[model samples]
Target chain A: MSDKRGSRAADRTEAIMRTALELGEEIGYAKLSIEAVATRAGVGKHTVYRRWSSKGALFLDSLLSLNEAHLDYPDTGDVIADLRQQIHAAINLLDRAPVGPLYRALIGEALLNPQVAAALNDHFITPQAEKTVARLKAARDQGQLSPDFDLDLAMGILSGPLYFQALIIQKPLTHEYVDRVIDALFTGMGPRP
Target chain B: MSDKRGSRAADRTEAIMRTALELGEEIGYAKLSIEAVATRAGVGKHTVYRRWSSKGALFLDSLLSLNEAHLDYPDTGDVIADLRQQIHAAINLLDRAPVGPLYRALIGEALLNPQVAAALNDHFITPQAEKTVARLKAARDQGQLSPDFDLDLAMGILSGPLYFQALIIQKPLTHEYVDRVIDALFTGMGPRP
Candidate 1:
């Protein structure tokens, strides 16, 4: 295809994703449909279908497009502080619209749909987890964490609570909550010496 | 109502719940319906609807009926060992058929439906959390944990990782994984003193 054709295709894809997010937040995942998204985006149904096979696929892409920057972990040489900052941002994202509802919906979809689940884990969950693991490894190397710290378990510990609160209990994610989690990890839950 | 009538109603309710579970496991949640459950149970649709308002409600009751024994915390005076045993059993449940798929389907429904979410938190999540909190309190009293250890965070810490693995990453939950999480909690992740 010509450069102009390639540019136009890219634009249409972005438009469809944007419309998916907007419609997702508006009508939620259950009610939103590809046809409606295509109509709103001024694109043909075939164009949307050609790109995304299902609503879950479309929504996952839409959520990732908006969430790329939020997944990065900062390394200011203080692991706990950096984690607190990043988790605070993550919880904040879950506490607000567009991302929060969209994410929850995606999770709902992922649970029921194996295809969506695999795609979500591949594109989103695995990458975010890897970044966090990398940061924790850096901390471990720096002696900020124990050399033998279980990085796999650490990954789950850092993320599991927040996800539990937000997705399972449907509770509000607070900054204080983030601090509490970080403090628990750093201080440890074991009996004092 | 007459005692005989009440007994009959109770028997019918049990049958309905049992059928709901069977149908949920057989056909899965997304495809299972109230009408189908009623038909399978050999009861009128009104009978099913009278007892539970929705499929989620019925499934929640069905799950609780089967899962009540699994949620209890064993106070063997060894908190870590008890937790390890309990988490191992919980993970075992998630790894198998019937309960695993049914619970996953319920979670999927709960995410999209607020009433289901609230009922799940109230009936399942909160009670299980409280049981764990009570166990932790007992441990703290016995000097097994720090007095100031945040039980709420601990509850999340204990269950969150397992749930994250089972529900989010869709990883296989194993006995070794349970031991790793318990060890992490007991040993602490902080830098060596």
Candidate 2:
């Protein structure tokens, strides 16, 4: 029965994390609460405190709970195509209300709250950013891009427009807009004769 | 002379806008007020009320006050050089605490407040964005870019990275980083040989 106990604990943890994400999206980080999360998840308040030190800690874990969505980074051999697909997917996710507001709130919180910022940077932001870098480095290795191509700059060119349009400018993150942005970056990064 | 009265009115308007921008940065939008702004500008509160309908309106005008800094959109015949210089100047402005926090706060406020968003989009965002598009169109006309280039998308590629870095990612806006971004976009947007 020890194994059963472990699995039950895991299930409870999953439920709590899922509830935290939902509450975070519905009401936002500013209004999200540990007490609400405990009651909604059908667990005791101490259960949450046992796992997370504070609301920010709980929210950070909830943010990571959504990372499964990013696992399928496209790798179709054509680096440009893969990059475009990945960015398009990201834009689509951001367009969804459940994910978009939560993400923006997290970013705003990151700007104002150091603990939240550190959690996001250490757990969510840096790892995902590194994946983008790795993909570009792989493309560079395959001779799909120029030898002198700056990987960091190429990564920025590829992803920057999407975030700028969707997040900062608050524009509609449509497929057409994504294509235009990708085409512009690829033309800039294409192999020179 | 009537000229003396006109100049005094202009000076008062300038002072009010300046104070609004300063107070907005020092505290933030949530706590900013017309009364405080009027007091800071050495004008009566009714004077502020007479000009602007609300604090958001006043702050929007304050934002426009800084637009003179961007008036010199370089047209030196070298489109790439001019673009780089323009973007570099923008990055520098964003890096400063005065304009930077105010800009970020506006964005944050925009997410939560529709009135502020409308004011920003109608006045500050759209008008400034059009100028960038105009500059690119001028370059395309000069054969510095392809005839078929999407001017809107090109604008996103050029400005998006700077904003994505400084605003969202909260990275330091360095001259070297700006140069790399410009080089990447120009390479993508350069005339297809």
Off by over 4 Å in 2: A44-57, A63-67, A189-193, B42-46, B63-67, B189-193
Q: Which candidate achieves the best DockQ against the true structure?
A: 1
For candidate 2, write residues B1-193 as lDDT tens digits.
8999999999999989988887887888779988999888888999999988777778877876776577447889877778778777776665677777777776676766667677767766677678788877787777777666667676567777876677656778888898877776666632344
Docking level for model 2: acceptable
lDDT of 1 by residue, B56-133 (tens): 888888877875787688889999999988877666665678788788878888887898898788778888888888
Clashing pairs in 2: A187-B188, A188-B187, A188-B188
Q: Which candidate gets the maximum TM-score versus the true structure?
A: 1
Tens digits of lDDT, candidate 2, A24-133: 87777789889999999999999999988777778777766765576346778887777767777666655677777777776776666667667766665566678887
Number of backbone collisions per candidate: 0, 3
Tens digit of per-residue lDDT, candidate 1, span A1-193: 6999999989889989999988887888889999999999998999998877777788888887875687689899999889988887766665687688778878888888898898888777888888989999999989999777888787787888888888888888888888888888777778868
TM-score per candidate, in order? 0.91, 0.87
Off by over 4 Å in 1: A1-10, A44-53, B1-9, B44-50
